[model samples]
Target chain A: MSVLVYTENWDGVFKKLSFELVSYAAKVAEMMETSVTAVSIGDVADDELAKLGNYGAAKVVKVDGNTTLDNQVYTGIIAQLAEAEGAKVVVISHNNTGKALAPRLSVKLKAAVGAGLIALPSSTEPFTVSKKVFSGKAFANVVLKTDVKILTLAQNSFEVIEVGGTATVEASTATAGEAKTTVKDVQKQTGKILLNDAEIVVSGGRGLKSGDNWGIIEELAEVLGAATACSRPVSDEGWRPHEEHTGQTGKIIAPNLYFAAGISGAIQHMAGISSSKCIVAINNDADAPVFESSDYGIVGDALKVLPALTEAIKEAKNK
Target chain B: MKIVVCLGNVPDTTTKVKFGDGTAFDKTGVQWIINPWDELALTRAMELKEDAGNPVSSVTVVTVGGKDAEPTMRKALAIGADDAIRVDTDARDAYAVAGQLAEAIKDKGFDIILTGIESSDYNGSMVGGMLAEMLDVPSVSAVSGLTISGSDVEITRDIDGGKEQVSVATPLVATVQKGIAKEARIAAMRGIMMARKKPLAVVPAAEVETLTDFVSFELPAPKPPCKMVDADNVAELVDLLQNEAKVL
Candidate 1:
């Protein structure tokens, strides 16, 4: 039996999450007493797939194609490869694309699957996996009893291990099913970090008061190299775009550090980012719910707290 | 035109999660609600139906959950769906849930199928994609805006680096994202009163093809104690990040 890691690529370059998954998969493989094989589908270059070796992949399976992530077709291919290689464990990143493919693959392989996994599997019996639950408010460990196991690791959950090694590349011949969806065009966001992948997020709420005053928030985000997010109320008020809103009723994110300035932590807002490793809340109200959920709380006006925090971060980065 | 919105009865986002002996979440004290994203989907469907000048014949909400989810299902009807269906089963995995929805609507002939990008509970975000594949229809994920023109639906989505716009024919599936529609409307008092009278059909789930199983559930390790550094000590904070936490 072998462990299979799904290596995701964008524009011919492997995503950082793919390396993270490989590193985690490598650990799982060691526990399973099997080597890890990294598989890349779509139009990824040979060198791109070869790079998986550095991330602990023993073998690289490159399936040459121009497939645009047709879920059924890709699931069938992965299933065929898993069966042929006798893979006992499969790992994928918990990204948009991975989210689209992993569940179907779980069904195809009849494996117990864990999504939103945030840590490595437990060494204890039954092989439990921990995953973010309730929109990141809490985490739950999932144990798999199935012989074949599937795991979708949350992005940035594990540190990437760089044990550069050579990976044996092999060409796999697999037939892809007809794609039901066609890609007409892809519109790309300009000059901003994708909220889902951002490491540090600086979010605002209705306290910002108006959309015109957003320059302060954007400036802080720019200085910190972080993404900008807003509360549901901010979005509802049209002070910020909906895509920038993060809450229980919106997008759930798990950044390394989340800075909530000029925002009270409503249960809804906390639900989206409670999974953040560290949260710093700067609000005038000491009784804000956000402070209760935050790792650090500063009872002060955001207009003052934000500029000071920005300066501090800038000075720290410069040092 | 007929639209199908797949809804999941999910725990409130703030609910504390307790892990079972195996890797399944404990449902104790968890208040169930319509998955937030699904609410967006339902709202968008209603918008489309209204925009079509009532050309749409029906908007059906479907879920795979026990009878306790009926109230949440009725909430969907109150919000504007024509009817609701609860496929009697506990939603264990994304694939099984998607399969149940797909089978229920296979021959029902829906022009468009909508679901949230991901449920707040499991965060699988794969059900819509899998359901689209199962139904053999074009699919789009995380659509922030949609406009139906003639036989095609123009969808705008937020991608990794940017936004994307695509056009697909009828009988397609799309996952609703934030900003896709206006703020979801609360059930009006009249609608809430009328919801009790709406048709909420309960049916046993068709034999589903199970792909994944939950062996058990456990709580995550407690976070380490937080160490506070003086606000003026920027250098110290940097040192802590680079050396102690090693996050940098």
Candidate 2:
């Protein structure tokens, strides 16, 4: 019997989220009185797989080749492996890949699943876990009645732990089935920080007035080394790309620092960013909902306040 | 091409969220709207159908909800779905919802299925993927762009740092976000009048076992009111950010 952790690997290496998964699964395995096994698919080096032991995996299983991950194929493989290993608990990251697979695995395994989980199980008896609901406005304590359980940990929700150790790597014979979709092209935003992985984010909204005035938001973001984002209205107005929009209908972010300049925090907008650690709002309206949710607020026009704040931060960094 | 656009009725974005006793949510007086994301998907599908010499044959909107949800289904038809289906039951979880949808879709012979990436209410973001897996079809998650040509559909999906373009054969599923359609269209009076004659089937919910049970719901703690600072004193705001908020 073992606790299984799906350690996602990309570009021949394990992602940072994979390390965090092993660290989390290790603790859960200890409580469950079982060893932790890390599962990897696609092109990953053996040495890299072995290094996961540092974060506390007892063993690593690699499903090799340049196979592109399709949700259907990966879910089948993981579910079959879990049953074969008698894994009582399965852990997955609550990111794009995980979100796409976890629910399918739960249904296939007939196991209860808790997704976007913010913390460890409150108790294993009834197998209760907490996950964000109503966007980020609320949390629900969900109890799983099934014998097996699946969990997808929310990004940045848990601390990563590493204890010195080593892991045994085993090459699996599991091959993916035929895929229905084929990749045509991949267009990467090569130079800019990705929103999901960014630690700091600077965003603007309709208050910027025009696409031409977006230079100030970009200048502030550049100074802070933060990814740029925009409100739904800004994206709708075509002032910014749709991928850069963060809100109820857009990307959900949890950056350490979030700057909302010229953005009036609509409830929809707040839903996507409420998880951010520290939100700073610069808006002309004192009554903007962004101020109500932000940790700090400056009552002024974003055009004037943003440049001043950017200069101040630049000065502070110099000092 | 026949398209199945999955819809979910949710409380309006502006609705104040309150938890009821036990496992229930306080839905009293909450005005429901067609989920904004699903509405966007429906609008985009309508645009494709309305274009000159378009290839689309029909647009069907499906949902897992009770009679109270029929109005929302009607709204979907008014917004331009050819027909609507409401599975009569309360949706327990994403898995159960997807199971019901898959059951309804298995015999429909839909060439393409579209759903919002995540519903505004629960934000589970898993149903579309689950449906795809159940039906044994190709699916793209959170697609921002989609173009259909013959039996091949090209989709643009946003990853953490980049965008990927993938092509899938017919009988494809796509969980779409905002960029699939720049704007959602309002129902014209003629569309609304026509929607009255549209077929809306209320099928009994399939007996699928639910995976998770909710014990309770809790609202997030109220944040302290914002501390208004003079706009000119950027230094003070900076100090607060560094010393207090520690974001710096």
Candidate 3:
């Protein structure tokens, strides 16, 4: 039996999350005393596929030519690969691809799935895993009673250990089912830190007053190399695009450091960001709910306090 | 065009979360609502149906849960669904839930199926994709915008950092997030009265064995009381963040 990881490839290379998945799969494989294999689909380069070995994958199966990241088709292929390899555990990153594929794969393989998993298996006896639930407000211990276990690791939840090595890439071809939906065009936000892969995030809220004031928020985020997010109200108000919204009904992020400026901590907003390792809230209202969930609360106006904090951090880093 | 909007009944976000026997959720005193995300999907479908010169015919809401889920289903109908289907079963894992839903929707003449990206209760965004696989249809997730013209469906879905436009034929499934509709509609008196007269069918759940078991539930560790820094003491806050929080 093997531990199989679905390593997501972006363009021609594997991103940070892909390596993290392999690193995690390696750990699980060690615990089971088995090897780990990675499955990559679409048009990724060979050297990129080989780099997965640095993280722990022993073998890489590259399905050439498929470009679109269609979850419906990938699910069928992964299910087939898992069966052929006698994979006992399937590891996938809890990103868009995994979110779309894991449950469907579980149904195809008759495997018990733990989605948005936060940590390693607590016990392998009953195959227990811990995952974020209730939009990160709580945790649940889920047991996969079935023989085959499928799990998706929460993004930024695990550390990546790099051990220098290279994996053997094997070319494989399988029928990717016809896509009923066609991607007419792909528009990616370029030249900035991607939110899902960001380690630190600086977010704003309606308290910023208007879209023009977002320049200050952008400056702070740029200094920190952090991705920018906004409260739901700000997004709804069109001060920021809807994609920047982070909350219970929005993107649930778990960066190591989350900075919220001018945002009152609404319960729904907190639900999406409470998983961050350290949270800092800056708001004018001393009674704002964001403070209750933050590690440090600055009872000040974000407009004044954020500029000062950003300049200070820039100085500290330069020193 | 017939569209099926999948429904999930979730505890109101403000409900103090507590686990029963540490195994499952305690249902008492929990006010259930049509999951905010699903409400968005339903409202969007209704708007498209009532759109000027649109070809949409009906919107049907589907859910897999016990009788406790009825009120939430009723709310969907009032919001504008023409009919409803309840696959009567205890809430199970995503796979079983999707299986029951797929079984219920298989023979239905629905050309489009919609679901919230994930349920707020479990936060599993897998059902819609799984349903697509079961029904052998195309699936899209995190759709922020949608438009339907005859058999042509166009959707705008959020990707890693931006959004993409996808066009697909009929017999497609989509798990939608917000931005599809400005707001979920509240059932008016007439809509509420009409909902009571609409068709609400209860069917036995398909026999699919659940895969995952909930061992226990626990709240996350609480944050320490906030360390307040005076509005002007930005320097001190930075020092605390660097030395104490170690996040700088």
Residue A14 alpha-carbon offset, candidate 2, angstroms: 3.0
DockQ of every predicted complex = 0.44, 0.77, 0.76
Model 1 segments more than 4 A misplaced: A123-127, A316-319, B14-31, B53-55, B133-138, B209-248
* lDDT, model 3: 0.87
Residues A174-238, model 3: lDDT tens digits: 76678666788889898989877888999999889999999899999998899999999999888
Task: Label model 3 with its docking quality class.
Answer: medium
TM-score of the second chain, each candidate in turn, equals: 0.93, 0.97, 0.97
Q: Write the per-residue lDDT of candidate 1 for residues A76-148, one digit (tens) a residue.
A: 7888888888998899877766766776676567676778787778752676776666666556555676788
Tell me how much of the true interface, by contacts, candidate 3 captures: 0.81
Clashing pairs in 3: A265-A290
lDDT (Cα, tens digit) per residue for candidate 2, span B1-248: 99999999999888888887847788899999988989999988998788755589999999999888988888888888999999989988888999999999899899989999888887778889888878878777878888887788888887666778888888988998878998988888998999999999999989887877988988888998777779989999888888888888
Candidate 1 accuracy as lDDT: 0.79
Give the poorly placed runs of model 3, Cα more than 4 Å off: none
Q: What's the TM-score of each model vs. the native?
A: 0.89, 0.96, 0.97
Q: lDDT by residue for model 3 over B52-107, one digit each (tens)?
A: 67788899999999999999998888888999999999878888888899899999
